[model samples]
Target chain A: MLNEKEKHRYSRHLLLDKVGLQGQEKLKAAKVLVIGAGGLGCPVLLYLTAAGVGTIGIIDFDLVDETNLQRQILFSINDIGKNKALAAKHHLEQQNPYITIKAFAEKLTSKNALELVQQFDVIVDGTDNFSTRYLVNDACVITEKPLVYGSIYKFEGQVSVFNYNNGPSYRCLFPEPPKAGSVPNCSQIGVIGVLPGLIGTQQANETLKIILEIGTVLSGKLLIYDALSGNSTSINIKRSEEQIDKTKAMKPHFASFNYDAFCGIDLINTIDITELKELLKSENIQVVDVREEWEQPRINELNALIAPLDDLDDFVNQIDRNKKVVMVCQRGARSLQAILHLKKEYGFNNLINLEGGLLNWK
Target chain B: MKINVIYFGMIAEAIGKNVETLQINSIQPNTDDLTTFFIQQYPVLKNKSFKIAVNQQMATNNTVINENDEIALLPPFAGG
Candidate 1:
């Protein structure tokens, strides 16, 4: 099945003993689905496309914003404001015409996840939130497909292969999602742009290995790469039947399972930054910033009171009870936690969360 | 006993260090006890969720820790 152009296109891969003519054929027959065309998704899509994977599917509802150019290398300034999956498809198609790339410009909801993942041989999770990540893992587990997982935070990244050859799933490692406000994302903190490239490349390599059956798969193993330290550490994990069964039990209700609630994407009283800006001009609202003092993008226009979430006890007496308090943090989750905490622990009822925090103020 | 313990992702930020030489005052402490010890030392760690790895292997609450073993406090990173 080697057309002249196909063989010439994959000449480099054809030369490798591990990925020769037969391996190239296998790759051409493999179908891989990538979720989230964001930071990690960029490199994974690029490399996988270049490697001549026969069919690739990308599903991301996000748009190609200017902020994505730093890490999402698929989109240029011309492609800004475009759907990420469609924009990625446009570039990847030019990279390798020998392959087929499918773009789904829709969000991966609970309803679509199971059916969509069932079509792919391997699922690559480059999503940025706990809810989607958990949803992807459960779908892969229920569908019995391998998932190549990668995540980045600041200068570090984590990579692992779950549900491969009956290995451990994500739940087997972290059975429960972290408290919603406890973990700050790249938007809240920041990420070294190159970090996801490294991690995503590793994920691409794993996908190729899985397809070619050449090397040791990263099943039941988690790889932690620290760009700052230039060191990679491995942690061995065991498959938990209980965790696997828990996911399988949801197979009947897979379409209706509320992953958002599972990950605590909660329903809390929130006001957007623009609304808060408008409110400050009219009413006397008390603004309390819940982020650490060291966090960036500080908004001084509100003349907000600084009360870090960790040490809120110190500022208990300072927060006015009579005033309508607006809680804020780097991304708003921590501020929501602050409101819930103050409301529950101290019986304060007049608290509201600042949606999306200071990061979205601009 | 003092052991080499490493922290990852947000856990490191909470502890204010990537790695540390932690001194355990308990006799043959389990993973649960070590976690409690850490929460007591760094109250900030009580916010983030993480798991423990003993010498490159995942540890359960009942997993025992020995002297000179490498320990890693790993957290699930939510970034891409």
Candidate 2:
């Protein structure tokens, strides 16, 4: 039974031909959990709150930064440096006072992923990295919860619903994470301010559709959108039968590995500063720093060259084929691309990607 | 064979546009041949890393390219 204020608060929603009284009731009964209160989470929570989801949980370990204000619409300049989940909860509650908003101000780890995910009717992933994406997928599979996933790069974004009614999981679509530092984050690269809002709103729409049982759900399908051309493409994803295991009958457990370590952040497997110093004695390989000119710790003694990523092509043409090129960048992403290009163009297969780049040089 | 060369993500930004086409007239051009063609045309691409997709699927360096196939030059997918 709708209360007097409730009826008026959502009168437009209740009057909609597709979403009537029953739909409103369905929304009121739904419990949704959103992971990450960053760019994607801001709009997702805002929309879900406006639509009157019964309960919403927001989890984030990060604090707000000046850099986040460009796309994180739920936050203001005053909220800078505050905990993201707490700030998001405070703001979202004010937006829709009738709906319940819970804030979990901690990192989402494998230990808590399964238990936390099982508590909600729907899970939305707004995480920005690969390991969390995988963790969310695995946990969703374990809990049989539907996941609305959205991600944005420089100018393109991808949105999908995974683990819905035994649909394909994120792992089924992307079996493995890419090699470390292969691509830069929005922090390293950049994204348009409105890109996340565009993608996040779409994610929120998918969540509502799932809750109210409305329009087509993006199950077993990956939708890729390009902001530049305004083009959208849907790729069909089929479930891999062999990958599905019936081991849920046994004790359910969470993953135990550190995602940062899994993503190659540890420096053990890579060459160290001393090893690099030893290699500098050889004239056969030329170390090219792809970091910007102003970046610190510039090497002056070694057999090295300064070539910013913007000028990599012009410098590539001048290199000698006899000398191997060891590319270096701040985070190794730009250097890897430079190495790949050198190997592809000049047949310099001897190029090596300086793991972790100059930041890990020591 | 004429193949449409599609650029995506950072690759498009580097190329300053989204779509382009390349003509290859061998029985099946090896990945090296396509690589050489691209580098020869746009020397700047020689310093950028990318993966080739034959009809929306990731292809390897040794993958053979057939005529009229839709080839996509995709930068690394950074999205979660």
Q: State which candidate has the highest TM-score.
A: 1
Clashing pairs in 2: B1-B24
Cα lDDT of model 1 by residue, A23-121, tens digit: 999999999999999999999999999999999999999998888788888889999899999999999999999899999999998789988998999
Model 2 lDDT per residue over A105-175, tens place: 99998778878888899999998887688678767777789999999997798888988877887766665
iRMSD, all candidates: 0.8, 3.8
Candidate 1 Cα errors over 4 Å, as ranges:
A268-362
lDDT by candidate, in order shown:
0.89, 0.77
Query: Per-residue alpha-carbon lDDT of model 1 for B4-78, expressed as tens digits?
Result: 999998888877898889889978988999889989999988887889999999985479999998999999987
| Worst lDDT 10-window in candidate 1 chain B | B59-68
TM-score of chain A of each: 0.74, 0.72
Instruction: Report lDDT (Cα) of residue A229, candidate 1.
Output: 89
